[model samples]
Target chain A: MGEDFAFWLAYLTNGKHLAFYASFRFTILAAVFGALLALVFGLLGAMARNSRFAPLRWLGTIYIMMVRGIPDVLFFLFFPLAFEQSVEWALSLSVCSAEARAGSAWPPCPAANLFFSTTEYLILACVSLGIIFGAFTANVIHGAMRAVPRGQLEAGRAYGMSEFQVLTRIHVRQMWIYALPGLSNVWLLLIKATSLLSLLQINDIVWWAGQLGSPNFLPQAGLVHGDWRWAYYTVLFVFYIFVTLGSEQVFRRLTAWARRGMPLEA
Target chain B: MGLLEAIWTDIQLLAFPALFNIYFAASSLPIGFGLAVLLALGKNSRNPVVSRLSSAYIYAFRGSPLFIQFFMFYSIMLALNPIWWRPMGIAWFAMSPLFIGPLALVMNTTAYTAEIFYGALRTVPKGELEAARAFGMSRLQVFRTVTWPNMIRVAWPAYTNEVTFLFHATALVYFTLPVIGNQKDIMNKATELFERDFNVFLHFSVAGLYFLVITMAIFFVFGLVYARMMRHMPKERQPHRPRLRFGPKYIR
Candidate 1:
């Protein structure tokens, strides 16, 4: 027990491992934010796809159709960079205006100092995740919206409800029951994908795990432990399994509650 | 014209690696599919041993993430034969981006495809198996003629989607391997282009477009194959057939 405590202390206090532990926050943050953003984007996309307007429907359909076809990794790299550059450009524009007006080397005032720092960079990363997963969420939500029977909407209309009322009261409420299962799948996938945020230098768990496992610092003098990334990764695997199981249980319970009166399969 | 030539050369250079990746993915499908189908069969098997082993394989593969599996394989190889690199002139299969890419994908894809095949196999009507047995058909013959063909017919659509997903997932290869000098993949090249040229927007977009084009091509070809297969099917078992809608319909 003492040996185990020492081993864990040595493991946790390592600076790189500390970064890795911190990275879990990013992972959890990204997962929650991405799910929420994707939910919003997905809802809007689904609404647009099912809209009366032709172009909006086409736009929504195309987004759903195209994104699933393209790889998530591609979007991971592309969207983040695109968002970063856009933010930088906006900053550059502000800076240039300040320099021109004040005749100083320093840039002028902006919305917040945070935007100039890593805070905005991380925000951009979050936005990228949202964009990447939004298409998946849209697919889930669109299917869910469709699952809300057309007759339900007509029934609402028969009760003298407006289109907006029918959508808000009947369609939206019922869509959750159908969407929950797929949305849960999307959430699970998003969690796995949070690991990829390390590639963007967000210092996520995978990155830190690699850092702590490197033999560069530790000289415990046993087997040298050169490339034991596997062990750390194994821990991550177990972590993910636990997370997925917990979330799945929660989602399953939610689904059961949502389907109180419906058929078992439904 | 020079720019056009460079682009052409780039495409030409990418052709072999792309083919290699595609070959690796395509070949693994059969092996993985075979393993998965066997497991699926085992899952439904009357024998306890077969059932238990397959159920275990399915759970282990499905429950874990793929990236960790790749790393685990690499570590295990190195630990087993540290000097294997000296003789073979290859350090580790995991470090070899080529091997890691395919290994991870095959393992992951196999797990997925197995479930798909298993589902389809289970849905095969019991009456058909009974009829085959009644006709003095051996177990192998029953499987070959009655079960296998119907499984393929039922599982083809889901199988097509899996193939597309596998092709897309191949991008993960870039992160796993030690990409030597210029032998990088489209994703690798895109990453390098971003760092070197700072043309993140242009380069990534180019890579994304490349992936989009390849995915479309695969989809079209598969569509053709699907159409051909459908044409060969009995008229009654065409797209409008109710059995075409196999698996859960949670997603409308």
Candidate 2:
């Protein structure tokens, strides 16, 4: 029993396994940065949707509608690929000869071909996540803006505040309380999506788990283990559940703090 | 090739693959709907064990990514193949993506749908329930007469949104599951086409068009049902009823 315990201890702490452990940063970074971008995009989207200008409102409608019917995975995959190719295409115009450009080939020539390292891909994945989830966040924020009491805005106006001042000081300030619940839900969805980062070639936790848990065979360590991916994935399943539990607790507290000094709704 | 012809060919190619997605959603929805109702009822039950179990099931499934759930369940089935499914001569039937795809989707959607139903369950009119109970109605009868209709009415709009999300999630099935030959879905086929021509724009847009059309179809049908359910109301006041609008409701 002691030997078995030692074997597992040594095995889990091996170099490849350490890399696996470190790869979790990719997931964490994607979730944090992706969510920040989503909030920014969402604020922009909501502001546009709420704008008086017809053209600005149309842009927001298009942005939000882009995600409405399509699966997040489709957008998640397409946006990065399309963006990479677009950049490469632009480069090809400047770098490639006319003959190379005439060829029906991607990048038009070798010079235009560019590779994205893990970090670059990670950044792309974050932006893709932002663009996809931002629509949901926009809906939540827009609704929250409307939920801000009209009287509060009126009082700000009565006190000689400009429209921008009333918006920033009164409407936006009070909107957080109403938006917190929906925003919390969006945050949960964004974190869950971080699991797909490996699909973009980012070496996230899910990728590492699959790699570490596959059957290992070698000249010296013959048949080290059979398939253990289920165990690895089970850990991930539990990890996410814990994250959700923690988020729920944190959001509950935030809601209580936000509700302070406000009269209770029946 | 003419641009329209190229699109036509691409759409025609994906036409069969699109059915695979429809199959995943169609096979899962009714079963998921039935299971969700039971789960929601279980969560609301007086029995502590039942409530705890159902609520935990909902939480676990809803909390995690469906992408991981697919891998998790598939890996478990793979591990089981040598010991159990093979021994029983059922490995082929048990491990097929066709079977497993809907199975995971049903599990995932049940949790989301149950939460919606449970929320609606709480909002059932207390007076109506009490009136039924005070009239000496049986427990089952009170639920049948007073609880079910009101819950469905209240839940219809959100339920419509859940159904659309579930349909959208069918895109993830092929990513985790092994596709046997030409059994690819829309996403799979689009990626394949993309590799051939590297036309990221055309293939994916066509794929997105298919999802958009089907989603609209779902909204239209559900709206009809919602409208029918609200027919007893006076017309003017009934606009507030939960009709499945074409635009965004809550989405995942």
Candidate 3:
């Protein structure tokens, strides 16, 4: 048992395993940035959805509808490629010389090309994830807003509070109680969605796990294993469960805090 | 090429693979639903061991990412044949990607669907069960006549969401498992074209449009069923309100 433990320690701490560490780091960072961006998008979407103007409501509705109507994996695959091409196209049009533009290829210029580094891809993944998840958040917040009692807003107005004041002081404050459950659900979903970063060629946990666990016959990598991918995937599965359970506990506490001083139903 | 001509070509290329996507979802949904019912029943069993086992199965499957589950299953199947089957006389252990892909999807969807059904089972009113008991119905009779139908009815809306997500998840199969000759799905075809012609977004857009149409069809069909099953409830109790939210509802 002692020897086995030592062997695993050496295997895991090998220089090659640095990718594993980087994968976990990037996964966490992506989730954090994605959640923050989603919050911003969600707030804006919710406000637009609730706006008095028809055009703003339409704009928000269209965004939510289009994002939600398709599979998220499709968006993850399409958005980065599409965004890169658009950037390259715009750059080629403006920056490339007339002679460079005479090429028959689509971009028509090599020098004006815009290649996305890993960081840019990560940012694009976060943005796409944010846009997809933000629609759900907007719906949750919108539903929670509607669930808030009309009398509370009336009470605020009775105190000579302005419309914006009533919205900020009463509606926004109380909506958290109702929205906590859905937002927590979205948080879990977003965490899982971060795994799609691997599809985008980002070196996330899934990518690293696939790389490390693939069958290797060469002697250079130390402790060559024959397709231990199942073992690696099992480790990933446990890690995700840990995250899920931990988040559940945290959300439970937040729900309790939100429920304080409120009625039982609320 | 012009944008219109390119998009048309992309759509033609994707048409074949889109059928496989449909096949994945179609074959899995019924099997997953049946397993979900069994799991829901097991979860509410009187025996502590059975109930705990069922809950653990649901929790483990639902908590993890489906992508990892696919990888695990693929690797396990690949390893199992050479390690366990070759020693034995069984020659059928060489599992194809075609077999393992749907197996993973069905298992994953079963977990989520079981949770939805379990939630609906818990909400089965106590008064109805007691009334059925007073009428001299056996436990089996109570379940078949009173409990099961009501559970399905209560769970239909959320189950619709599960079906939608499951259908969407079919797109992930080609990504996780190997795509043998002519076995590619819509997303696989789209990515192939995207890689072939790096600058064109038309291929991906065509694939996305196909998925959008499929999603709408799912919503329409499920909405009709929901309306029919839920017609017994009062109008106010029915979910007439539009569900604008677009995330996977399985986590709830």
lDDT of 3 by residue, A1-266 (tens): 99999988998998779768867877888899999888788888999999999999999988877777678888877777888888887888888888777876666777767767789989999988888888888888888899999999999999999999999999999888888998998899999888788887788888888888888667686657888888888899899989999999999999998898877864
Q: Write the per-residue lDDT of candidate 3 for residues B135-202, one digit (tens) a residue.
A: 99998999999999899887887887787788788888989988778889998888877776574467
- For the second chain, the TM-scores of the candidates in order are 0.81, 0.95, 0.91
Sorting all predicted structures by lDDT, with the top scorer first, yields: 2, 3, 1
Question: Which residue pairs show backbone clashes in model 3?
Answer: none
Model 2 regions more than 4 Å off: B240-252
Q: Report clash pairs, candidate 1.
A: none
Candidate 3 stretches with Cα past 4 Å from truth are A99-104, A218-223, B85-94, B227-247
User: What is the CA-based DockQ of model 2?
Assistant: 0.60
Docking class of 2: medium
lDDT of 2 at B77: 94
Which candidate, 1 or 2, would have the higher TM-score against the true structure? 2
Chain A TM-score for predicted structure 2: 0.97
- Global local distance difference test of model 3: 0.84
Off by over 4 Å in 1: A1-19, A94-118, A216-225, A263-266, B1-17, B81-95, B234-237, B240-252
